[model samples]
Target chain A: MSLIDSISRPRAVRLPRIDGLIQWIVPLAIIAIWQLASVTGFVPTRVLPAPSDVVLSGWKLLLSGELVRNIWVSFWRASIGFLIGGSIGFAFGLANGLSQLSAKLTDTTLQMVRNVPHLALIPLVILWFGIDESAKLFLVALGVFFPIYLNTLHGIRTVDPQLIEMGRIYGMTDGELFRRVIFPGALPSIFVGIRFALGIMWLTLIVAETIAASSGLGYMAMQAREFMLIDVVVLSILIYALLGKLADSASRVLERLTLSWHPAFQKR
Target chain B: MQTALRTALPETELASQANFAPHARVVREERLAQTSGLPLTIRGLRKSFGDNEVLRGIDLHIPAGQFVAIVGKSGCGKSTLLRLIAGLDKIDAGSISFGQDVKPEDIRVMFQEPRLLPWARVLANVEVGLGRDRASQDADARAERALTEVGLADKRHQWPSVLSGGQKQRVALARALVSRPRVLALDEPLGALDALTRISMQRLLERVWRDQGFTAILVTHDVAEAVALADRVLVIEEGRIAHDVVVHAGRPRARGSVELAGLESSILSHLLSADDRT
Candidate 1:
């Protein structure tokens, strides 16, 4: 008999999935009330436009292709910045975590640099790159770097020593030990870093875009604010919320895929 | 603590700790059955962590396929000796030579913790034991054979996290066995297991030892467990083997039998009396 068949799968109780819309009730009600109030002029339109007005602004931007372009720009900035910063941080973490000499050489300097608020350097960053793409990239990368680096380093350091000893005793080579034991052991913590960095990634992009930029969602919002297009401004805020949620969900999906064996992830 | 364990309960009480059939098919391979164990020659083995000497000149010889157990109080350096023997800790002032020029996989250690990789499925965790041969064509077959030997063939696809504590330790045993190790150093492997699980594991350990004929060196705190499994029991006091007791009993010795219990009682009393003296 195939052993795989005997694993006794936990069948989650199924419901027809109009069941999912139960969670949407409050949000829909709020949206309805806000739209009603906005249309009847219960609240001044200039201060906070109706949800429909914001949706109209989004439609206008979408038809003109401005929405897609800005979304693409923001996505590109966030991802590229994440990749560059994340890789560098990962490399440094590996080097430092695995070697006393490397740790001694650079960890103190990195820690000192980490203490200074990354956003506080926005003024100097603007002066350095002057509204160019590099300023935003720099800010985003810098914002993304510390969390990943710290988490990666902490992850590597806290990996169970007994497991390492067992690996060596079982005849694992240095590379094999790292691949089969060290990396997997540190992965949960590393994922923590990824989730944290993703948040920082968008936060940095939004701030950088809003402060100085020719393109991106932040620039779009900034332009709307200048022209007092409150509906567009509100739409940008909603879009930022959506973007943040989207990014977090993507990381969560990746986390679930890799860490399916983790106890916390073993449930339905 | 010693007094409580010294008092042997009824045989049925001891027998209730059985998680497996009394005679499970543990002997998977008979190709090279009897002479698989490597003889160990440890000469004046000394180990110290800085100024504190853990093992002070431990000179001992273990014959091929001998089941030896070392027992001692908390600070008596039993684990230090085992670590030195396993080559996990460096000897400060001596040599430990094996009967043959052994490769890394020839010797294996099973620690108290199962140490199964949580990221790996049960089968992959067992495959980790094949060492350099883990990538070979027959590695999966060998691991499957080992898992079968431990009666855990069916749980191979499950995650390590899902397995019960006893089952996890059994998987660790399968991993250690997958290497076809000539020497298996068990550092209180059953220490973390519950009483029922511990007894079941003890039997599994003995069956595998008899089947594969590996040099088994178990370091433990449980006197009854040591008496139950090991052919020879060595009690350490002040980093030295104070008593080298041999159990002159036949195979498949009954659990909680008077003979075994008497020996366990005497050893525990001696250990306790010594503790009081210190």
Candidate 2:
């Protein structure tokens, strides 16, 4: 056996599949580099603490329940705002799309409104709603509204009119047409709106929280930055990234489940 | 616009077919007969987009149970004519009245594409042609029967995507037929099918037309298909009926027979001549 081992080399170590490896590799690589930098003083310990220190801080915050409290406050703000904004956007988009006069009157104004960034209205929002949660929620809601509206309008308008005629000739009532034909036809675009709206929700939330909040991951990061608690600041940013990823993945799962009939999502 | 083919066919045969089987004289005539005097009259149908006139002062009366096949080359207003009849588009200077009391629900159109809801099952799509009160268990049974007519009874739960192109078209036909509509309009229903599939579907359509006896108006680019299937093929050119040729070959038409081939060739030449003229 010893002679054979010497004569014939052992097989090379096998690597895991790309998808399987990515799960652990990315987080490990990040932690390892972070640890290495901290140890080497490439990035100063004071300015950018070690990965272990950030993890410790994160655990402490979690255990104290401060993180959960702040996270819930932030989530509720986003959720309520998203619902309000998303519904209005969907309704208006569909109405404008179906009616010629409504579309002609509203499209130009909507286009103009969309060009003006939601953040540009921060001062005005603060004046109207004050520095309370309502102002922050309103900002996030406003941020989410336009993309959902525009995408919904585009989706509704682009449905084949032949299909609509088919619906009509088949004795489908207006309600039946909307439910069976129009809604399903526009679903893929509606999902696009949801995705875009989700993104905007996060952006507005972060900006609003940073500017005025007493709590929230965004507020925590801002406070940590002022105190030069580099590890805590890093932890807050990481929390934000995780939350955003979780929300996006959840939306994608919902989309896939609902739009199973869509060409892209259909199983082989 | 009388053509050589029209002149070649015996005038007596034309007159005899026109008078003898007046109900079966055209594709939609048999269907119109089922309605027992359907007053589907149109006068001076005109449509235009900017300065381009797609339809120009066209007048045609689709009597009850008239199975009319409107044939035209691309941009010859064949589809426009069908759309006008189906009431999918409004005529600029024409009036279409389907009797004095005909409801919109009584008219059913089967388009070239199935236009089925991909998310909906075959049965549900078939039932889509019926209203809520009309969509009962009996209606569902009727839908199944319609599916059976199309030879797709077993595919009731299948999604539209899972079906073949021909199967999808069959489902569309079932949906159109399920309504028991007085007027059934077909806009090149089999235009997208492969050659073998198209032949089978033609047979299926003939079978269904015989059984259901609904008025069907088909708009097709295939002159041979028109001659083989339709009772009277109406050639539309420049928004008017240029020629109307009756196929005296009778039902259960033999596939690739000399008589059928001769008629097909004659119709093909007419279309080619029209193309050359343009």
**Chain B alone: TM-score in each candidate?**
0.87, 0.85
**lDDT (Cα, tens digit) per residue for candidate 2, span B109-185:** 88889899887889988888775535576988988988999999999987788899999999998888776777888
Stretches of candidate 2 off by over 4 Å are A1-24, A40-42, B1-66, B91-105, B132-134
Against the true structure, what is every candidate's RMSD?
A: 8.4, 8.3
Candidate number achieving the greatest TM-score relative to the actual structure: 1
Top DockQ hit:
1
Clashes of each: 0, 18
Distance from true location, Cα of A172 in model 1, Å: 1.6
Q: Rate the local accuracy (lDDT) of all candidates.
A: 0.84, 0.78
- Fraction of reference contacts reproduced per prediction? 0.88, 0.56
B35, model 1: CA deviation in Å? 3.0
The runs of at least 3 residues in candidate 1 whose Cα sits more than 4 Å from the true structure, single-residue gaps closed, are A1-23, B1-33
How does candidate 1 score on lDDT?
A: 0.84
* Candidate 2 lDDT: 0.78
